[model samples]
Target: MSTLRPGRRFRTALRLAGIAAAFAAPPLAAGAVHFSRIAPLTGYAPAPAFDAPDIDVPFDPGKRTAVVVMSNTGTELTDFLAPYEVLAATGAFNVLAVAPEARITPLGAGLDIVPHLSFAGYDARIGADPDVLVVPFINDWRGAANRPVVAWIKAHAGPGTTLLTICGGAVTLAETGLLDGRRATTYWDFFAWVPRAYPAVQWVQGQRFVDDGNIVSSAGIANGIPATLHVVEKILGKAVALETARKVGYAPVAQLADPRFTLGMSPLPAVLLANAFRFDKTEMGVVLHDGVGEIDLAAVLDTYPRSGTTLTRLVADTRRVVRSRHGLFLVPRWDFASAPRLDRVVVPGARGALDDAPLAAWARDRHGVGVTYLRGDLGAPLAADRFPFDLTLADLARGESAAVARWSARGLEYTPEDPAVLAGAGWPIGIVVWPMALGLLGVALGTLGVRAVRTRA
Candidate 1:
């Protein structure tokens, strides 16, 4: 199915404002009470739900055209893999991951990879020029390790070799003087920053890419997929680009023409959740749930579909695949270390508390700045000491959902285990269960009466 359009995007933005207004009670008096006086995020308001991307296009390896992806120690996985996977699936290109060193290179998150070609190794071993050179976003644009790779691009990649860059990878290519004084684009989060970094290059906004004949640059990590689709069209044909996009369940957008890259990045301090886990929502909603065990988040993902604030799942470890309580596996967008800075975090409750020390450390470090959500035992130490909110889990669970509103400003969403364990659950399932229980009792009684009459006869 297609994604939500601009109108719904606007409505969701407004709905988020409404949720924030609902939760923020009483005027903030000058010097009387601070904004911190508000309770910790208790629970989330409801939102339109959406299914995570599940298109599994089969890989077909045929054409041996050389496609080399340049990387360093801290390459963003999505920026590299999204385009690499798209190109590899076409069976048209031979993809190789090349780094600066011969040894195994550690990547973002906890993942590691062995390079197919090192800067010097490629020249001595393969010795042949590749048709396409892909540069992924790295942790730092001006890292010392990237000097060799930049030199390689400068020497070989020009006019004949199609050099494609994802997000901040443009900076790497720009260092070669290739993109200098040429139209280019980078990740939206750094839309302004990139231009400031290299004023010589004309950084274009409101578009997915700036394809200046031989070079191609994309907006962000997720936007890389669309940018690569444009490349597929350039190499293979329009038919292939459309076919690849269709098989992958993504519509092929026009080249050099995606305006969405500009609008969302202006807002900072957005909420960032680890992207993973399948939820039972209909449309892509605002609030997110990152499952730690075999736990179902159907009830929890219900809140904040239209929540205007940002919500994403961040992988805390090397693992991108997350298995839910029902064996639902999902790949998240961001990992812990590389995730964008945001206001607060929401951790869903599971059957057992996971030993995620890194998350605890991050929370402890940002105790005053951001709210750290811990469902059940997960929040024990953090909440007990720095329980800055006027409300508690117990309070929200017992009282009406309105009490949870205090924490809903940043699109707070949660699913507590055993809602009945509390005085009463504020969700729909908690309130609707009473009538269903009475109906079941009446049905049993009626059946028993009929059996007794039959026995008498």
Candidate 2:
């Protein structure tokens, strides 16, 4: 197979990485993948060994343990701080920042933090028996030199104690063979390296976080806070977890399975940039067009930034077209030629109610055929009077929609409304979409002509 070329997906990721680099220094770690959104669970099977224990940890108000964080170059400081602050607020655990050497760590934005402990001159007695060991992300400090840190974790964590690592930090833990034969997750990038180095470990490609008994692994740096929150909830309770989220700007929907809170990398900047365009998500596909008027094919082709364009871009760049399983879609420009012909039609009434006159006309006058009108607005009656045709309008009674009725009438039926099915097919409707396209096209052209005349005169 061919190796590769500079592709759209590649450029977008590079641009996003560039923006992140401007905020913080480039990561010194070899290779770590930032995570996207987590995929849905496909299968469910119970594992007795993976079940949570019924017994609780003995409450000791003063018996809190600190998570030793080592700040290195390109280390995500917020990844460390978010969890540190949340853990502290719980009034259950304290955090002590440490470094490889006995010196101050220069965080991003000139915020200098002194290392509480140093590996060169290490002493665990200063801090309590850290019931939980958390390895904050380190962009550098890899290879044999990390043996001491790995040894310390193996020695310190007791049978009852738990060990946790976030993002690239998990790579360090994996080096210790503690993750062997265990299900784990890291920011998506390090996936290649983790499995290559630790063959025994089971790498979950799309999970936000996976709990293997006392060991917990999380996706990327973005999920560090939530992963720590999971630990807080496990050690403390749901009440404390919810309270911590409220204290921060985080939502309290941190159920162990919810990856939205933690699995993906920060999509704020990218989403913000994309939101500048009028994003219209339709049943057919997603449409990005000029909000001021109907879809301008030229503008769509010219206006979009190549680095930040979507997964699917239409030929006319201004509008992106997508289709669902049921043949529903969204397109910036109404291109009947690019759309599918529909035998069934439904028009909506004013005030967003359903209207059936158009369907009646299409069925009766144009062809001696029947059309099932599903409920939706068809805009103004552009040719409702002239193209008056005959059609039958049937109100879909409870559990009596055409889809079901068709299935009942015939053993098998056709569904034009399945998003997944439509999306997969990438079917275009060129012949039957003339009405929708021509009306919108005329409006667009007229508006442009008016603007041009005003500009010249």
Candidate 3:
């Protein structure tokens, strides 16, 4: 064998290093982009004001109307559903889900939803000012596409409507200038950015929800339950609110906010980075049917996808839209016959034995996939003083990886009831190790090929 010259050896080594770096850079860059998308570390530009002509909508004499506003592009899953379900369950108000357009609205990390009324539809049909107008976090809140939504909100900002903004929906509400000189709270992730974006609004930290008379704002996703219940108590009475809370299996807290939620440097960033960079992921199918519990569905759809190991799809027997228990319209993505082969099937809601058996059988017989339930006979009961999100976390810990469960909790800024479930969970070693191993192998192969070419020359 002819030994290489010193210059040739040095050049070969440089080529190998370059090959390794080329193999590694794409994934690293992509992971960083993915992480930034989820947790925005950058500053936000101020929201622009959209001038909307005031439309005098007459108030209905019969019952107070509540409209949960939806955007055609995307809305946060839990923020939209939890409040809608809780309010509808009380049966004290005429709760309606309205969208900017009549088209299907995609929810962030969940199924597509069809709102009951479009802005035009609501104007033509109800022709009444909503007593409560709920603004959920939408994907394109600051973009030009959201001008119509901003204008509609601004027009309805009179003293007659109670404006409730859930999570980052506070940003949207702030766009309407309603929260100016009002105490408001939002998702903890926004603490750094939103205040700078809207300095006119007094932003409160460590609060689950804030009520400055007509304008109300909730801290984050799961907190929507307690905040909405608080609204129920304000409108109906403590008795009705308590009953509604009991029905939903939620225990109300006396404190204005939980001090546990805040942002800082922690293992969460590393964990998020690992999950985002993970190459091997499972495709999970979620069954959508009529009368599915909105909270249950939201919990599964929101939690599993965040784990970074699972991709969720809304599957149904038919392609038609189905109504949730509280009346949020859900449009299924795939019919069972046409759906891609899935690693597993998730059945959400606390549907009783009669409803669950068919789903389990179909998942088993037709697809040969195992079924996981969000609640009821097959699934664990909601723990005492726990929300549906906690149930989802527990399921993630048990069914998937403990590390993934912790990641989901960290993403939501939620503290789990049992620390034991997430104990010892850390960054996925495979995410780092596998990529390094493959990169080394690629470099070695490239070096061998280069040497062979030199020998032939």
TM-score of each: 0.48, 0.43, 0.81
Those runs of model 2 whose alpha carbons end farther than 4 Å from true positions after fitting are: 1-61, 71-74, 108-111, 119-124, 252-257, 260-457
Tens-digit per-residue lDDT, 1-457, candidate 1:
7498989988988866644443332221211232222111111111112233342212224444444455554566556655665676666776666667644443333233445556776677555566778887765557786777778877767456787888778888888888887888886557657777788999888676778887888776556667788888888887888776654435435532443433312111111110111111112111123443211121122122212122333344433445432222333344555454544454544223355465556645743233234344322433322211212333333432332322231122121222332233334343234334444555556557657989999
Better of 1 and 2 by TM-score: 1
> Quick one: ranking by lDDT, best first?
3, 1, 2
lDDT of 2 by residue, 131-195 (tens): 67777556543645445666666555667666777777777777667888888887666776778
RMSD over all Cα atoms, model 1: 21.5
Candidate 1: how many backbone clashes?
Answer: 21
lDDT string for model 3 (355-448, tens) is 6677777788877876776664222544423566777787677655576677777666566545653544445677777556655666677668
* Total backbone collisions, model 3: 0
What's the C-alpha lDDT at position 216 in model 2? Answer: 82
Worst 10 residues of 3 by lDDT: 41-50
| Local accuracy by lDDT, each model | 0.49, 0.42, 0.73
In terms of lDDT, the poorest run of 10 residues in model 1 is 269-278
